[model samples]
Target: MTKRIVVLGVSGSGKSLIGKSIADTLGYPFFDGDDFHSQANVDKMRQGTPLNDDDRKGWLATLNAILTDNPSAVIACSGLKPEYRAMLRNGLDDVTMIYLKGSIDTIWQRHQKRDGHYFNGREMLESQFATLVEPTEDEALVIDISQNADAVLKEALTLLANSPTH
Candidate 1:
């Protein structure tokens, strides 16, 4: 059976990298949530403005639609808040969320060396940290980000393999 998984984390937590790997390994298409953002929203992030909930509502709705439409897929998103994760989960009966848990310092270091991204690392780092509401025990699979990318991906896949869907 195909499974829908959401790779969630704060920015710089390797959601995109790990999500893609997991999707590839499982032969599921990967969708980066950033791609669903409107140009205006992208611009706002580029300017280091933390998006208010209102700014994210439409985008979350759009993501939920995509998940609903393609039930056999993996998605990478910064599901920073509990409500946002619930929004992403809307109407998706078969969904597994993998939260890439990381420290602010680790994320900050990763962001500092990151290049070719529109977001300014220093400006957005604090806001990302501030806005993050870590996953609850009942909510998702939590993977520590202190591990290497490959290790993280492997761990996630192992968890998924043992998951009820598999």
Candidate 2:
């Protein structure tokens, strides 16, 4: 009963933190989608440029391959669009998406505390929200992230445990 999970959210929405926790708890590998970005894409984000769909295509493909290769793993990715999520889950049957829902102000506070991260600026966060097509209940198990990290992790784990698919 291995689980394949993708923690989805905008930058600063605790994707990496929660995804890693889930992976560690489940004894599965954890991958940060940010690590898969090309140097060019990283530079663009660093320079405060919003990446269009073209910039994300190759990166999404790589992440998709990772999911395809690893049957049981947790991935942290800003899957903002329905198409992007579809691409990420292209060939995976048991994939579960956990969307970390948060407001811009909440995420902004979190982003301000970040250090040396490539994805920066308020405008970038705005762009992500604009691009985001929130998943419906059927598309994902949405988790509100205003709570403490421990609580969020507990909720996520509980949800996964109770999920009919699991």
Candidate 3:
């Protein structure tokens, strides 16, 4: 079965960087979920406003379509809520979810240093955490992001390899 790896986490948790590395290692396509968002959503985020669930429906559908089309792909997305994750899972199988977990201070520091990110500053990160429903073991392969990217990627691959879903 084709593997659909969703590298999920809060903003600044290195989802994009880690997802790209995993894609490179697995020889699959890589997608940044931020690209799937509508301009309005981007605008709202740029203004430091958190996206409400209503604002994300279309974006989720678009990502769902992209995943449906790709047999094997690694996508960096903030699957913060279970409902949001479920929305992403519609019509898909062979999905291996990786939750990149991290402390607020660590990620907030990372968020501060990042440049040209639409998730500007650390304003919405708190909101993101507040909105998040951390995925359990049954829902995703969880890995802490306190380690280096290489280590995180290695662990994610190992967990995916061992996961029943994969």
Candidate 4:
């Protein structure tokens, strides 16, 4: 069966990096959710303004469409809220989520060191943390981003390989 994985976290948690590695290891196409956003959305975020639900509404629909149409892809999305995740999984099954968690300090440092990104590292951090609703008690494998990328990928791969759905 085709499997879909959502790599979720606040900005700078290495969701994009780790998600790419995971998808590559699993031989699945990888998508960075940021690339899916429209220019307007990007512009808004670039201005250090948080997007309201209305701004996200159509974007979520597009993500849903991608997930539905491409059954074999792994998507790296912030998916900051449960509602957003629900939207992504609207009609899908055999989907797994991996939360790449890191402390505020760690993420802050990473974001500060990051170059060429549109977002203001400081402002977006709070908004992302505020909107974040961690995975449910019964759902998802949470991986701490305290270690190197290699170790994190190994752990995530082990779970994917051993999972019943996989």
Q: Residue 163 error for model 3, in Å?
A: 1.6
> Taking the tens digit of each residue's C-alpha lDDT, what string does model 3 give over 50-123?
99999999988888887899999998999899999998889887778899999999999888888898896666
Q: Tens digits of per-residue lDDT for model 1 on 1-166?
A: 3389999998899999999998898888899998999898999988888788998999999988888988588999999999999999987668889999998888888998888887776668788878889887578888999989989988998888876531
The best candidate by TM-score is: 2
**Which parts of model 3 are misplaced by more than 4 Å?**
none
**Which of candidates 1 and 3 is the stronger one according to lDDT?**
3
- For candidate 3, the lDDT comes to 0.89
Q: Relative to the true structure, how large is the alpha-carbon lDDT of every model?
A: 0.87, 0.93, 0.89, 0.83
Pick the winner on TM-score between candidates 2 and 3.
2
Off by over 4 Å in 4: 164-166
Q: Candidate 3: minimum summed lDDT over ten consecutive residues — where?
A: 157-166
How would you order the candidates by TM-score, starting with the best?
2, 3, 1, 4
All candidates: CA RMSD in angstroms?
1.6, 1.2, 1.2, 1.6
What is the Cα-based lDDT of residue 44 in candidate 2? 98
Better of 1 and 3 by TM-score: 3
TM for candidate 3 is: 0.96
Please list the residue runs of candidate 1 whose C-alpha ends up more than 4 Å from where it truly belongs after superposition: none
Model 3 clashing residue pairs (backbone)? none
Per-prediction TM-score to the true structure, in the order listed: 0.95, 0.97, 0.96, 0.93
lDDT of 4 by residue, 1-166 (tens): 3378888888889988999998898888898888888899899999999887888888888877887888787888888888888887888877788888888888998898889987775878988888888885356778888999899999888877766532
